[model samples]
Each structure stands twice: as structure tokens, then as C-alpha cells.
Target: MTFIPIAIYWIIALWGLFSRRPVLVYLFFLSLPFGSFAVVPPALTGGLTFVPTPMTAMLMVGRTFLDPTILMRAISSALDVRRLGLLTGFIVTALVSTVFMPRIFANRVMVIPVRGDVSTAAPLFPTTQNISQMAYLLISFATVIMFSQILKNARMQQTVLLALTWASALTVATGMLDFASQYLPVAPLLDPFRTATYALLVDVELTTGKRVVGLMPEASSFGSLCLSLLCLLYFMRRAIDHDRVRAFYAPVLCALLIAFAWLSTSSATYLGLAAFFAMAALEWIMRFLDSRYNLLRKRYLKAEFAAAALAVVAVAFIMLLHPAILENVSMMVDRMVFQKTETSSFEERNMWTYVSLNALVETWGLGVGIGGTRASNSAVAAISNVGVIGGIFYFGFIIQSLLRSAPPDDKRGQVLIVALRYAFVPTFLVGLLIGTTSDFGAFGAFRYGMLTAIGVTGLYHSSRMRQRRIAVSPESA
Candidate 1:
């Protein structure tokens, strides 16, 4: 049954590969969330695991190379050569370390795990797994760059966002169905193939029985993808021209995504949710203050004050009836946030961090190798796997890109860019706990790459627009 979607996907993908119209390629990008079940058969391709997203990325990169003009234009418009050089240096350093680093350092073992306990162990040097990881990273980087070039104008950007919004809506609907299937006897008939795929890919023990894995490999992964889409939708809403139907569906989709994240029972999702709401609240306060002072509207001010008072009263009332009324809330907070620190999972991550630090010290900050240690944290992984020199280039490239992609004076674009930048704060902080910079297979990396490309492309267009405005009105400037 899973073969059905896989077959249809290949049909479309092949058409896209051969067609002159770019719409098919855009459709392929938007449909990546559905690719979890579109896996290639292990018997073929020498037992190499292949998914549609990465396969499509490889095709796109090949297409770019086929047209040197497109590749050169994209590089010139979307990238700063200096930053590109730094990125190249980082990649080269990793390659060099993989070749030169020792296989065994005092009998220490380096394991590269894809999911759960399934992993490949090697010594300090790069194994086949490490090389595969490097390939994934390069593919991901090329994919983002190609998409950024393709989505140059405002119309293209809007098209991509609209496609993304629809895709997210579908994903949320599927997740809700998955959750309902747990209780409904006839739910299997609604999504038979997806249900089967979930059974095949999901680790039942880790999901805690109630969490919905959706179309992703696990509940946590689905939650991460949802969180990322939510952030994108929130920012893109401000930049795109509004439609009544889209406006109506946007909030409903957000509500569904939030519910799905909560039901996934991932602590990382909870933390991200907390951070998002905090930023939203802060933005709301700033807007309210700005309106109050600039517009000087007494009615609006009075309404705002009344709302604040009501919130205060509600909190006080809840506190007064705390023991019985808030027991469930307190218990949830304890389980999701507080008590998590005492769990074995937290201890394991701590142990990984300690080991990574020791590796860094032992190697004199030169790193062990590309896949030498399992740090479970991006910053630690950078130091331990890539060494200090590579880490500097790696982090430096990201920071420089963010700085260079500052939005121009367009109010809507500025607001969107600012929000997107703030959204990255929580994601980056979370990565320090359980992600790597070069983890190409994860949805988080995909989201990060997409966001970065959007910022850079938006800034490029915004700068051009600003220049035109200046040229038109020299006296005003």
C-alpha cells in the first residue's frame, strides 16, 4: 500500500526533472513533508537509504550545474564571497580531519547513530557513516541555495509561502486523524498506508502510547516540524498580501499545530512553545504602547487596560483555588519541565557533554574527527568533531549571514524579518541541548536552512527595492 504514494511521487518527480516549467520543482519542495513513506527499497542502490527530499535536492543541484549562468548568478546575488570562503574552509577542514585523524585514541569508540540504539561505531577517524553525513550536509546546503535563487521575486516568495501553508494544514489534519485513530475503530480505513508506515518506522516505547507520530518518523520529529512551520507562517503572514480565506484558515491551522505539538509530548516542543508565546506577548505589548502614544486614542487605551485587568483577576482567582483547580496544570508542568531534569535522558545527555568536552581537551581543540564523538549538542559537537578552527569558521559563517541579512526599511518586511530572527533564538538555544550543525537528516536543519535562505533572499530584494525608491526620490533621501 505504501508503494502507491511512492509511485505517484516518482511520476511527478520524474516529470519535474524533465520539464521546463519550474512549478513542478516548487511542488516537489512543498511535498517533502509527505516523503517519509516514499523511501527507496533497501535491496536496491547497495542498501543505501534514500528519501525523496534528498533525491530531489541532488537533482536540483545537478540542474544548477547544467546551467552555469544560473549557478553564477545565484552565487553573486545570494552570497557574500567571504562568507562562502569561510564555509568552504569549514568543509575542507572536516574532510582533512576525516582523512588524518587517528582511528583509535586509547581505545575510545565513536558512534554515529541515526535513530535510537541503531548506530555505527568507528574509532576517531571518519567511517563510511561520517562520509555519508558529509554528503547529506552538502546536499542540504545546495538545495537551500538553489531554492533561494529560484524564489527571487515577491510573487515567487508568496507562491512558496502559500504552498507551505497548505502543506502545513494537510500535515496537521493528518496528525489529528492519527490521534483519532487510537480510539476510532474505522480510522485505519481513512489512512491505511500512513498507519502502516507509522508502525514500521516509529519506536513504540518512546512515544508513550498517546503521542501522535503523524507522517514523521517519531512524535518529537513531527512536533519539531510543526513548530517550524508555525513560525514560518506567523512571519510570512505579515509580508504577504492578505486574502480573506487564507486569513481565516491561518489561525485555525496555528491552533491545530499547537494542539498537535502538545499532544506529541516532546519537552523540546514545550520549550519552543513557551519561547514563541513569550516573544508574541512582548511584541503585543510594544505594539499596544506604540499605538497608545502615537494615535492617542482613549478608547483603545481603555480597552487594553481592561484586558490587562481581566487577565490579572483571572490569575488571582486561579491562585485562590490553586490546590484543586490547578492540580492538573501543576502536575503537567512538573512532568514536562521540572521533573525532566531528573530523568535518565537528561543524565545521558550530560554524560555525552562531559565526554565531548574531554575529547576537545585531549585533542587540544583540534577535534577528534568528523564523526569522532556523540556530543548531542551542536556547539559541543562543533568543538569535539570539527575542532576549534573548523568550529570558528562554521559558527562565523552563520553569524555573518544573519548579520548581513538585515531587512530594509519596508515596514512589513522589517517586522517579518525581526520576528523570524527572534524565532531562531529558541531554536538555536534548543540545539545547544540536542542537535548538531551538520545534522542534515533532521527537520530542524531543514527549517534552519530555509529560514536562513528566506532572510538572505528577502534582504536582497528589499535592498533592491530601497535602491529604486532612492533613485526615484533623490530629494527625499
Candidate 2:
């Protein structure tokens, strides 16, 4: 009997992997248990109530109490570890790339040929990195692995893109339904829908009404995810330009997603959005400048110019329509610019920054493990937190990657690229500087995790650009 239930989960997981359908994958993820009751076996489902805070911990503990064979049978039978393994490989490669590739490229300074021209440049990111920075680099490497492997297989890429598209669509649908749920009476049949739908809208101030946070923990995170998805949509739109149906819907959906982000009033999210837009603009500007004035035109400058113009206009318009967003942003900038010593949060952050420096000197090159807290006379113990030297290292890596990745010749390009690439930098910097005064290493893994994901995307994009250029050269042609 137990084997039967285990078999079901395995079967579903396997189907999800092999089918390689993006829509199905999105459904699978979103449909997965968000509560302990849903996660519990159907036979035991009725008894569960509280949702676990650390989902992975719950899974591990659940498997421990459950029959080992049953757990193994389910996990091994359904899911594709090969995909996971490939993802791991990509991350490992990224790590190596981060640690050595930059230094090698710097040393070699070879004139690697581009389309119709010879080019030589140093790689993105340097060999020397701080511990916190290393952590983000490693995580970024992992995300790249996932993106590359998934995209490498045509079927998988299609599946992923489709899933991402539909997932984006579904999020929109869920948000709408959530808004509608606020006014209407709930039908028993629509009870589940109501719960799922309404859960997305959040109350920012209990009295001032709720803002839409969606399935994410907060409005800001939700907004950030939407912005990330918008980038994905932009990629999809580029790929599916010929498909009028998808092309039309993609832009509309992207607009809606942006609107949701705006409504959330997450200032940090704007930084990321701005960063991506700035990167897009830089790419466009470079191509345009090259075409108009280059000794030889190597890339499509016209397309870049058009794209950049569109992006700039779209961003400007979004801001123009939402004056409240500007107000919020101004207030935030003012807070940061004229920081006061009176605020306890600000004061504590200053203390932590100093503490991290002290800890760094005490540790002297070796870092405490990721999310480690020691009771002994370690620097972390003395500081009563994750320590600043580590924070500096982690934050430093993000900055380094951005600097290394920016397009040559444009200072604006360099700054924008850094801001986008190191999207988590400001937030983490805020968390370190003003938001949370404590050592956030243990508490704020998500911020680091996001940095990891973004870094991997940037690295993968860099590698792909090189691959595309290399593949199209003389011999391949």
C-alpha cells in the first residue's frame, strides 16, 4: 500500500522530467505542496496542519521517519537526476571560470577573432575574491548550469520556455483572480481558487489596504521575481518574433508583470529592472555606435539602437504613469543619502560593518563556513553575528563580476552593467547597512541565493556570446 503511493510520486516526477514540457513543469512546481497538509501522504494528509518554515528540513525529516525504501523508490523513480547532474557540472565550470578564467584571459591577452575581426580582452571576474563573494559566484554558477543544460536540449528548451511563458501567464491570472476575490462571495467550488488567488494580494499597511505580493513571501520579492520573469519574456519574444500570437501576448503580459511590480512599491526591484534595461541599452548603443563610426561593423547596431530606444521609452513611461513610485523612490534615496545616526537599525548596521572588519582580521583569510555560527572564541562568536569581513567578501564578489562583465569603452555601460549584474548588492548592502543589523549570513541566505542565480545567468550569457562568435567563424561557416 505504501509502495503504491510512493510509486505515484515517482511516476509523476519522471513524467515531469522526460516530457520536457515547460507548461507542465510550471504546473508541477506551482502545484507542489505549499502547506504541510498537502505535502503529507494522502493517507496521512488529514492530520497535518502547520506549514514548515524550512521546507527542505521538513522533507529531510519526513524521509527520515518514513520508510527509506519508499522515499528512495519515489525520488529515484520519478525525477531526472541527470538534469540535476548537468546543472551541477555547469556550476562547477562557472566556479572554475570565476576562480581562474579571468586570470588566464588577463595573462594570455590573445587576439581571439570575432566576426570579421580579431579581438583580445580579459575574461569577466578576477581570480582573487573574498569569501562572501565566492559564495555568490558559486551559486551563480549553479543557476547557469541549470539554464544551459535546460536550453541545450531543444525539447527541454522548448519545454522550459513554454513553461516559463505559461507560468508567467498563470501568475497574472492568479493575481487577477486574487483581486476579484476581494469583492465577490466565495463559492465552495471556488474555495481553493479563492485561497490561492487572494493569497497573492498583501496588505502593506493593515489600514491602508493590501498590495499584491502574489505567491511570494512579500511584495518586494514578488516584484523582483516578476522583473526576472520579464527578462525571460524578453528573451522569448526575441526568439518567437515570428509567432504573432505569442509575440502580442508576451509584451502585454510583460507590461502587466511590470505593473504588478510597480504596485508592490519595491524600490530594490526597480534597481534590478533598471540594471537589465541599462544592459540592454548598452548592448544596443554599442552596436549602433559601431555601425555608425566603427572602422568595421562587426555586430548589428541598428537592432541594438531600436531595442535600446524601446526599452528606455518603456521604462520612462512606467515611471511617468506611477508618480507614487517616484515618491517612494525619492523617499528611499533621501533616507540613504542623508542617513541619520538616530535610527537604531542604521546604527546597528554601522556596528556590524565594523564588527565584520574586526572578524576578518581575526579569521585572517579563512572564512567561517556558510551560515556557520560558533560558540567558541571565533570572530563570529565575538561579534555575535556572521561577521563583516565575510559580508565584504560576498558583497565584493558581486561588484567585481559586474566590473569585469561590462562592455568596453562606455563608462555608463560599465556602471549599469555592474548594477544589473550585482542586483542583490544594493539590497544586501541595505540589509548590511540599514535593514538588519545582525550577521545576516544565516538569516539572509535568500539574498545571497538570488545573487548566485543572477551571476550564473551573466556568466552563461558571457560564455554563450563567445560560443556564438566562435561557432560562426570561418571553419564552421
Candidate 3:
């Protein structure tokens, strides 16, 4: 199933290499997971078996971890090369282990499992896992910027924007479908849609009914995506213009994503959404102040006003439909300020933050090596003891970059860039502060790539926009 699409990718990679396009190489590398697992697999897996079970999709998605296997297989078949480095590596490692640890082997040695919120004994391509994880971390922040740059130079910007808009729209739609199917009545003997829909809606809980992950990875991830989409839509509005009729879908998508997130009953995710909303709101307020205080020129003020108003109306509608924002905020207030523990999440985060802080004391300067984030038996211990300081440095680099790169343009642009910059910082803090409670953020390549893409892309676009503004500005006169 993986071979055919992989063949096409190899062809493209060769073509890209032949063309001497290093960026294409980078993009091709960035795209392997999404391409092999995300795009081409439907035809491959769908064709292999008449029935496309959820497990197949999961397996394909899971292949992101085992990309080394895919790479090796592709190399051996396509290049017909024998004894690739990995084979030599396996032999050398096995020899070293067998010779040095013969007694260890005689004891029927057991492999100590890596601690994490979740664990799977099944091996993924270990090498690919590491490579992809790093790639994602580096690439996520660049994607948006690159796309924006491409749009700036190319006539294809409209098509690209439409594609991205559509992808986000579909994600919103699928998530809503998942949410609605959850609440709607199920009839077993009815048609496939009715039966399948009913099955998706069944109530299930995790951690002894303490966690409800919902259709998304977790409720919080779903909420974050929804909230991020809303922000993205607002940000992109100036770039793409359309009739008022189609513009309505933007708000509708945000509301639907939030609604589904609420139904999932993910308190942490809701908290994340609230944080995002607050940041966005603060941006709006800043823009308003700038407009009032002569901080922004009269030229862009009207567009800013329209954006702020649209954002507010959309948020108001979302809040009206799902009042959980208040409920979640109240729960947080009661817990944090009032000094009461309402849920495990609250308790876990606090514990982890303490531990992480202590860990920072021990490893204060240089960071712990890679795999430092490997889970500990306890969340707090894992965070603080297992290289807490290093994590801080890692996150600090991100925070500092955000602070430094934010556009210093008109008040509106400054506020918008600053707000966007701070958006993910809090989420990262939550994962850190919340402790080792779970491996929510650092688990897979896809999400890591996503974060990197958002960060890099945002920074790149802001710089470009700033340059463009300067290039044409009257200030140069």
C-alpha cells in the first residue's frame, strides 16, 4: 500500500534534486508524512481492502513514527542497494549487546519501557521518529511564512489560499460532523449514515471517566485548532476578498468547532480556547485604542474596524451557543484564586510546575540532551528532575523569538502580531506547568511540525509584510 505513492515521491524528490531546488527538497521532506500517510493512502489502503477500517487510517498515520522503515524499503527496492547503513547498524549493535551483556541476556533480560502518558510496544521507525520530530519542530513556524511569501510573488496565491481555506473548512466540517453525530439519536437498523453516525456519538470516558478526548486528539487540541482557525480566518481576510455571503462561513466554522469542543467536555481545551480568545480580544482592544489615539493612520483604520467588529460578532455568537466559556473560567477561578482543587487536571498541572521548576535548578544552564522530555513515572519528577531547566531554555528561545519578531508597525499591526506571538506560548506553558500529567504536546511528528510551521510561517510573513510596508511608505521620502 505504501509503495506506489512512495514511488511517486521518490520520482518527485529526484526531479527536485535534479532541478537543483533545495527548497523543493525541504518541502518534499516536510511533505512525506502528509503525502504518504495523509494524501495518497486513501487510494492505496482503500484499494487494498474493500473496507477501509479506521484502523488502516490509524496505521497510516502511525507510519509517521516508522518512517525509517518506509525510507529503507523505498531505498532497497528503488535503488536495489544491499546492506544499507541501518542493516550494518543493526548487526553492530546486536553484536555489541550480545558480547558485552551475555549475562544480561542469560537472565532473560527485559526491556525497560520508556515512561509516557501513553505507550505502545509496537516499534515505529525509530530513526524517522526522531528526524520527523525535529523536522516538525523546525518547520512548523516556517510554513505560513513560506506560503505567504509564495502568495506575495506568485499569481498562484489565490489558488493556494483557496486550498488552505478549503482544507481548514473541511477540518471544521468533519469535526462538527463528529460533534453532531455524538448528540444525535442513533438507530441501529437504519441506513449506514444513521448507524455509523450513532456509533460515533456513543459516550466514552478515559482515566476512570476523568478524561474525555472526543473525536479530536483531545478536547483541548480540537479547541485550539478551532480557535487558531478563527484567528487565521481573521488574519487572512485582508489578503482574500469575497462577497459578504461566503464570508459568513468563517464565523460559522469557528462556532461549530467550539461547539464540538464543548460537547467533548474537555475542560483543559476550553481553558486553552479562553486563553486564545483573550489574546485575540486584547489585540482587538489594542487596535481600537490605536484608532482612537491617532496611533494608526486613517487609511487602514476602516479595514481594522471591520475586522474587529467581525471578530467580536463571531465570538459573541460562539459564546451564546456554548456558555461553557463562563463555566470553565469560573472553574479555573475557583481553583486557582480560591485555592480549591476541582479536577485532576488542575492538581496535575500544579504538581508538574513545581517539579519542573526544581528541575530547572539542577540543570540551570545547558539543557539536558535529546529525549529529555521522555516521561517520568511522575509528571512533576519528569518535568523538574529530568532536565526542567533545559525545557525552560527551549521554551524561552521560542518566547523570546516571538517577542523579538513581532511587527512594530501601526498600532493595529503591532497588537495583532504581538497577540499572535503570545498565542502558543501559554499553551506551551500549560503543558509545562500541568506537569507530566500526560504527553499531550511532544508525542508525534505531525503536531510538532504543526507548531513549527505556525511559528516559522508567522514570523516570516510578519517580516515580509513589514518590509513591504517600508518599501512603499512615505517615510522613505
Candidate 4:
């Protein structure tokens, strides 16, 4: 049953490849959030499990080879000696660790508990699963490199952002429908399709009885996706043309996203949202203070101060008249935040982290293998699986990519870059909790890769444009 969608996807992907329309490839990549069907390849059914995203990534590699232009460009970009060195070092270390280190340190079997069930043991070693995981990780890295070359146009960047916005809206709508299914008959109609897409379970809040998982494997994953997209949408909103209808609808879409995030009821999502808003508010406040003093500024600040005063007064009134409301809020926070540390899920994550560190120690900092330890944190997973050397290269590549993508002199672009940079803090924190090195595969890697590529490309073009202007000027010479 899962193979059906996988087969259909390949059919379309092959058509796109032969037709020389790379946009089709890009579209397929963008649609990965909806491509969760899991299938086992007949040839290696016992050894390897195939997911649509990794399959698509392999197809993309094939497409690149078929089109020499893309291959050439990717090769040219790779010629940057430092990036090439880092990438090569990382890949070599991962391969060596996966093949040799595990066998050398074969004295211990690393046990990682599965989520939802604490007693079940999932052991890790240099098995076929680890190899397959390494393959997928490599594919993800390759996809990011391919996209950095392909998504050079500002228009393409806008198109990708618009596509992501639509996907987010759809995810929120489906989630709402899933929630309504508890009380409404028609809502269940959507479940079959969702199930086929690999969303096997619906997560419901115990307190509110509201369903939250949407296309993702779990509620927390869905919430994480929403938070990431929300931050992206907020930063990219200004880039959209104000004269267009999308601009009019953009705020509405943001509101819907915010509502979806809240409805997720995931603590991590709440933290991410809080961080994003705090950064945004800080930026706004700084901007407000820096602007020339005028009647509008004074009135705006005065209104803000008045609103704060009113909020305090209202809070006092509530404390005096409706003490239960404050008590309930505190209880809710305790349940949602403080109490989480006592849950089995929290224990499972901590166990994974502990096992990961142990694995790192067992390997003597040489690493066990990629996917050799089921650590919830990417940094821990990287260090434990690929060794300290590989970890440095892996994280170094990300930092270098971000630095290269730094916006130029354009004020709006610079502001957008700052917002995007701050957004990474929350994403990183979430990754530290329960994210893979590929950041949950193409769903995360591709989106962030495109954003970085777009920023870098835009900055390059901006510099070129300025150079051209200066070259044309007579006074400068």
C-alpha cells in the first residue's frame, strides 16, 4: 500500500527529469512533507527501508548526472578549497567510523529505548540500518548542495517561500479537521488519506481533547514544523510585493499559523514561538528607539506605555476578583512545562543522551557510526556516531554556510538575515532535544538550504549591481 504513492512519485519525477524541467524536481522536493509513505525495497527488504524523501534525493542525484550543467555548477561551487576540505573530512570520518570504529569497539551493545514504550530495547551497532542511515544522511547533504546551486534566482526563492506557506496552511487545516473528527463525522474522511501518507496516529491533548498531529509522524514534530515555518514566514513577509493580493492575505495567513502553533499544545513549539516573538519584539523596539523623534513616535510610545499600564491594572483586577484564573494558568504551565520532566518521554530522551555519551566514550572519541546511537540531540548524535572530528566538520559546514549567506548593504535584507539567524537558536534548541543530524531529513534540510542559498545569491547580486553602478559613474573615477 505504501509503495503505491512511492511508485506514483517516481513516475512523475522521471517525467520531470526527462522533460528538462528542473522546477518539477524542485516542486517534488517541496512536496516532501506530504511524502511520508514508507516502503521496503524488494531487493533489500530485510536490510533497507525506503522513504519517499530519500528516494527523491537519490533521483535528484541521478538528475544532476543526466544534466551536465547542474553537475558542472555543483562541481564549480565545490572547488572552494575550505568547503571541499570540510565536506571531504566529514564524509571520510563518517565512513571510517561506520565501517571500522564500531567493529574495533564491539565489546558493548548500546541500548536505546523506543519512544512511547520505555521497556522495549532498540540496540545500535554497525549494522545495515546504520549503513542505510548513513546513505540517507549523505543524500540529504547532497540535496542541500544541489539546491544551493539551483535556487540562485530571487524569483525562485519567492516561489519556494510561497509554496511552503501553502503547505503550512494545508497542514494547519488538516490538523483542524483531524481535531474535529472526534466530534464530527465528516472529519474522519480525511484520516484515510493521512494514514496512507504515513500519519498513522493522531495526538490529542488530554486536557482539551484537541488533535494536533498533521502530516508529520507525531504532534511534537508537527509543532516543530509549524514553528519553523512561522518564523520563516514572518521574516520573508516583507520581501513579498506589497501591491499584490498575497500581501493582503499574508497577515491572515500568519494569524492562522500562530493559531495552529497554539493549538499544537507542544511545549517545544511554545518555547520556539516565544523565542521568535521575543526576538521580533526586540528588533521592533530597537528600531522604534533609533528612529527620529516625532509626534507619531511619541504618541506610539505613549500608547504602548499606556497599554502596559492597563495590562498591569487588569492583571491586578483579575488577581483580586478572579484568583482562580491565575491559579489555573499556573497549573496549566506546571502541567505543560514543569511536569514534562517527570514523564516517561523525558526519561527516554535523557536515556538516549546518556547512551550517546557512553558510546562516545566507548569509541574513545572516534565515534561508533552514523545512526549507531539513538540520541535525541543532533550534537550528541554527531559526536557519538561520527566522532569529534566529524562533528567539527559537520557543524563547521553549517556555520560557514550561514556566514557566506550574510546579507549585504540592503537594510531590509540585513534585517531579514538577523531574524533568520535568531530563528536558528530555537531550531537548534529543538534539535538538541529530538532532532537528527539531517534535521529530520529533506523536510528541514531542503527548506533551510534554500533560504541560505537565496540569501547568499541575493547578496552576491546586490554587490554586483553596486559594482555596475560605480563603474558607470564618472565622478567616482
- lDDT for 313 in candidate 2 is 95
Q: Name the regions of candidate 1 deviating beyond 4 angstroms.
A: 20-35, 75-79, 102-125, 185-209, 286-326, 405-412, 440-477
- Each model's TM-score? 0.79, 0.48, 0.49, 0.79
Could you give candidate 2's per-residue lDDT for residues 22-128 as a string of tens digits?
43344433432222112234345432222221222222224322556644533432232221232233233334433443343333322111111212222222322
The stretch of ten residues in a row with the least summed lDDT in candidate 3 is 189-198
Better of 2 and 3 by lDDT: 2
Worst 10 residues of 2 by lDDT: 111-120
Name the runs in model 3 displaced over 4 angstroms: 1-164, 183-215, 243-246, 291-340, 349-365, 374-400, 403-419, 422-477
* lDDT of candidates 1 onward, in order: 0.61, 0.40, 0.38, 0.63
- Candidate no. 3 TM-score: 0.49
Q: Which 10-residue window in model 4 sums to the lowest lDDT?
A: 292-301
Specify the highest-lDDT model's number. Answer: 4
Q: What are the candidates' C-alpha RMSDs?
A: 5.3, 15.4, 12.1, 5.4
Q: Kindly list the per-residue Cα lDDT of model 4 for residues 1-477, writing each as its tens digit.
A: 444655766677677667755545554545545533453343556524465557667776677656788787667655543333465567778888888876776656564522223344355445665676788777876776666666666566556566666666666676677667667785445533343322255645567566476655667777777777667666555555433524455556666777777677777777777777776567557646766433322223444456557867988998889998789757766776779899997887788788778878766788877756667777887788888888898788667555544444444445445556655766677677776443236644554455455555445657777887899899779
